[model samples]
Structure formats: C-alpha cells, structure tokens
Target: MRPLLVAALLVLIWTSPVTARATGSVLSGIAVEDVAWDDGTALQIHWRTKLDEDFRVLIVREGTDGLMDTLGLFPANVQWVVDDDVTPAGTYRYRLSVFDSEGILVFTAASHGLASPHANWFHRGRLGEALIILGVFAMILWGTFRRRDIYLRPIGGLSAIEEALGRAVEMGRPVLFSAGWGAQLDKPTTMAAMNIFGWLASRAASYDARLLFPTHDAVLMAAAQESARESARIEGRPDWYRPEDIYYVTGSQFGYAAALDGIMERQKPAVNLWLGTFAAESLILAETGNHIGAVQIAGTDSTIQLAFFLVTCDYTLIGEEVFAASAYLTRDSMVLGGLWAQDWLKIGVAVTVIAGLVGTLLDWDAIGGWLRGI
Candidate 1:
C-alpha cells in the first residue's frame, strides 16, 4: 500500500506544473508614471496580467516600513488605474499581484515610484498663450533698447491734456487731479495715473497753473507730492511745486467725495482730471465737476466708474486707455515699446481666436491643438 501511494503522488507531481515551483505568478510590466496636466496630485499605474478569467489582480499600496497592503481587487483584464489622492512630491510604491483559483498567490509585479506630480509651467493645453506672452514681453524690451517709433491711435482723453491745461491757465484756476477712493500708489491704476500725472504737472507748471491732488490715502498723497515736485523740476519750474498742493482728505469714501465736491463748488477748478480707481464716489465726483462747469477729463480701469465718467466728463479714457494714456502722454521708450508689443499681441490673439472658432465649426482640431501645445 505504501509503495502504491508514493507512486501515485510522484505521478501527480510530474503531471502538474504547479509542483515545479512553490508559487507561480504571471503579472508583469507594471509601471507608474505622473499624470499629465495636473497640479501634482495624481499618479497612473499600468500593468499586464494573465488574461485568463480564472485569475484576479490585486492592487497593492505601500504601508509603513515598506509593508504591502492590498488597496483593492481588480479583474485580470484591467490594464491601468489612476490614483488621484496621492500627495505631491511624495514617493510611493505599488504592486500588481495575481491570484489563482482556490486563493493561491500566483504572481506579482512591483514598481517603486513617486507622487511627485508637476504643474505644467505652460499649460500646453492653452497652446499659444505662453508663446504670445513671451513674444510680447520680448518685443517690448527690444523696443526699449532699439528706440524705435511705435505708432498708436490717438486717444481723445490723452490729446485733451494740452487743451485742459490751457483752459486752467486761461481761467486762472487750479487743475484738479484726483485718484478716487481706492487710490493706493502701489496699485496698477494709481501707478498708471502717476505716469499721466507727471505729464499733467509738467504742463501745468509750464503754463504757471496750479495743480491740485486731494487723495484719500496717505501713501497716494506722498507719491503725488513727489510726482508734482519732480515734474516741476523736469519742466524747469522747480518753484511751481507746493507740497501742500497734494493733501490727504478723509479716508471715508463719501466724506472724501463731499470734501472734493465742496472744493469743486468753491474753487471751481478750470479742468478736472479724474484718474485711477473709484467706487460709489465716482458718480458723485463727476456730477459735481459737471455742475461746477469744469472741463472734466477722466480715465480709469473701473468699468462702472468709467461709464459714469463717460457720460459726465468732457473726455474719457475707456478701460485700458488709461494705461495707454500713460505711455502716450509720457512717451517713455520702454512704455511706448510695451504698448507696441501689447498691440501686436492683441492682433495675434484675435487672429488665433478667429482661427479656433473656424476650426471648431469645420470639425478640424489641428489649429486649436497646435496653439494649446505651444
């Protein structure tokens, strides 16, 4: 009986390939890679496993001390999975393991990888965006060095500078320039206003006319004083600048408007140049200037305030025209160059947008894809 049993076991072992190895596995080619176009929070895992329906794949994630823990079970046919809960710049390891019928471990394929996802510096999906930005800036900087002429369309508000100053001079009244409620010299609107203010101060000083700046912010007042003095000096009328001319009004929004309105009613400035940012006080100031019968010239980036000024003021700088006025009035080489670069960039953007629209309508993706890839 012992001889018969031993012979039968040996025959079974010889016939079954599973006895050749203690455990057998058929999972292979497992890999991990970063997910594209994301903010570094995802990873993709890919693997090949036995295609036979008899096998199941286990997705294993790393635990502490490099221990493996089963994340989930998957069908053998699944080739890839995306893990979006991973942390950025974190290292990780994953395994694709196979199991056979009767719960026997069959095979495993591991890949030590990372959660270090990257933000696409230039969203290749946006195609020509980065290229356009770089090209525009490069052209602007080049304009600064080359001292080339940049053609710009005539802005009515910018062209009115001399006429406004002349009116102030003729009327023997001060020229009022105000950066309404949100005036912080560091802000973009205020900075642009300063550029135009320099020209205003220079022209006013040259004409022996007074320039007034009543501001709600102390910082803006200080900047305005310095700008006035510098402009006076540049225009060869150093004595024309008075520190008291740029004064700080109350910080309260409506209070500031009331104070300026009083001044407008009493002093009746010949030319009222409203620039920078404004809120509710925008209409208040414009209407007061109108009531006082002053020649009001206004520019602002604030859409709502700009609309008010357009209807109330004699001349208005619409939207980006305020920034453009800075370049046009000052004629600084760098600024002019920036304007030229910006215009060309706008043209390029318009063309691309039209092309993209046409392509989308016609069912052609090449134009859109190429721009985003750039």
Candidate 2:
C-alpha cells in the first residue's frame, strides 16, 4: 500500500499542469486597474510584473468573430501601457505576454475584461483636477486674509501727480485728464485713474483751478463727470464741476488725440494727467501736453508705452505699481491682501532667480534643473 501511494504521488507530480517549471522567464504580480482616456481615441493601462523581463502586450477581442492584436512591447516590470488612436467605443479584451532576448516565452496573467471608450467631462479633466482648482481658490483667499501693505519702491512717475496738480494750481490753469481708451472696466489701469482722478479733481476744486476731463467712452465719461461733480460737492464747490469740460470726444484714437491737441493748445492746462491704457496715440498726447507746457503725470501698465511715457511724461507708473495704486490709495483690506500676496510671490521669484544664478555660476544643476522642469 505504501509503494502504490508513492507511485500515485509521483504520477501526480509528473502529470499535473501546475507542476510545470517556468520557461526561463516568470511573471508574478500582474494587475490592471480602471482604464484612462487619452484624448478621444486612446486608453491607458496600468499593471505590475513580478520579475523584470522584456515583454510585449497583445490585446485580444473575444467574441464569435474574434480578433487578436499585438498592442506593443514594453520593459519587464513596467507598470503602465498607453495605447493611442484606439478604435471607436466598444467592449474589448486584452492580454500581456513575456518575451526574451531570443523570442516570446512566458505569459502574463490573463486580463479578460471589457474596455469601452465612454465620453465624460470628469474623465476629460480627471478626478485630481479639483486639487488645482482648490489650490487657486486657496491662494486667492489666503492672500485676502493675510493682507498686508506692500513695501512699494518709490515711483518717480506716480509721485509727479501731486507736483503736476500743484503746478496747475500755482499757474492758475485748468488741469487736463485723459482717462485712456478702456478706462470703463474696473481693471488696474481704470481703477488707478478713478483713485488718482478723484484725488486730483478734489484738489483742483480746493485750489479753485479749472479741470478738463476728456472722455473716449460714454460710460467712463459719465462716471468721471459724476465722480468729479460729486467730489466738488463734497468739497462744498459743486459749481466747479463743468459739464462742458467732461464732454464726449470721438472714440477714434487719432481723432480723440487731435481734438485734445486743439484743447491743449487753446486751454493751455498747466498740468496733464494721462491715466489708463494708451496705444499709438500716447506719444501724440504726451508731445502735445509737453508742447503746451503742462506738467504731465502718466500711469500705465503698458510695457510697450512705458518708454514713451518715460521720455515724455514727468512721472510714469510701471507694471505692478499701477495695479497696487488702488490698494495704496483706498487702503482696503481685500486689495491690500492681494497686493501683499503678490509681493510675497514676487519675493519668492526674486530669490529663485538669484539662487539659479548662483547655482549656474557654480555649475550646479539643482536649482537650474528644477526651474527648467517648472
């Protein structure tokens, strides 16, 4: 009985399929998660291998009319496979096989499941996109709560505003203000104009000096006129708000400047404030203002026109300073918060740039490579 049992055990060991030895290669922890979409056509496959071996995946479609397709080859132990330009939406099966330096030998654990290409916005954007969205909101809110006054370096151009207004009062001449082309929207440029103009117009009333406000947009012109009138009333001098002075000029760029040039020649304002965004007509207005002997103070974020303002205007606001002007003027909490946040960001940027420069000089790749990746 013991001999018969030993023979049966030997037969079971020799004949059982599970006793077969690996054919010079092996695949262990094979897995496939949910498929990911690539564009409108492709799909991404994620899997794991037990051993490191060179292998290729062959995706097969199982049905009565079956078809087999060799997907592509990838490194052994590779955990991912991306197949692009796949056929239209349908259920399909997939499998992976192991290959050697010579030819294909070992097979991977079979993956027989449905692969359907479905359309979805969440999939299009991805589940993790909430991270970016939430991060942006957090930054904005963080800026608002951590609000602090930004240490602004002195700007010669912006500082000239008071000087110009004072000069106009001393000279007994009207102050001219052109509220740029797109000053209607409450963007940085337009907001700067509102704050600066409100202050200047009030001072002009106090000095008993004339103020001329030219408008390119009806809405902005209306707002400026009302604001100036309201400011003059606040100063107990509503009569100083002249409706004709805030009259509508043509919307055409050249036409507006030409009309303004005529006014500058005749009225001869002692001070000119050019605020908001300007274009090709900037130099034309500046040159005219200069010719009329107006002490010009300009503020803009337009890099293209900065040089023009620098050459022509007595004072010019540059870049972020224009954006920070409202916060500086109003001292509002939320605006100050944003300005402080941006200032910190700017400091971070400056430090990164300085670090990169030092690292580059030392032939170090740490900072340089990290910046390149970003």
In order of listing, the candidates' clash counts read 7, 2
Per-residue lDDT over 1-374 for candidate 1, one digit per residue giving the tens place of the 0 to 100 score: 74463344334433554422224446667888888877777778887765676666666666334654445666677778887766675667886656565445565556854435565554555556666667777877776676677778788878887888888888899999998898787788888888888888888888899888988999888888888898899889999999988999899999999999999999989999888898989999999999989999988888878789989998998878988887888788878877877777788889989989899999998888875666
Candidate 2 ranges beyond 4 A from true positions: 1-153, 182-186, 327-338, 352-374
Task: List candidate 1 segments past 4 Å from native.
Answer: 1-30, 34-90, 94-128, 148-153, 183-187, 250-252, 331-334, 366-374
Superposed on all Cα atoms, model 1 deviates from the true structure by an RMSD in Å of 10.3
Q: What CA root-mean-square deviation does each model show from the true structure?
A: 10.3, 12.5
Q: Give candidate 2's TM-score.
A: 0.58
Model 1's alpha-carbon lDDT is: 0.78
Most lDDT-accurate candidate: 1
Provide TM-scores for the models.
Answer: 0.70, 0.58
* Cα misplacement distance, residue 85 of candidate 2 (Å): 15
Instruction: Report residue 120 deviation for candidate 2 (angstroms).
Output: 6.6
Q: Residue 116: error of model 1 in Å? A: 6.4
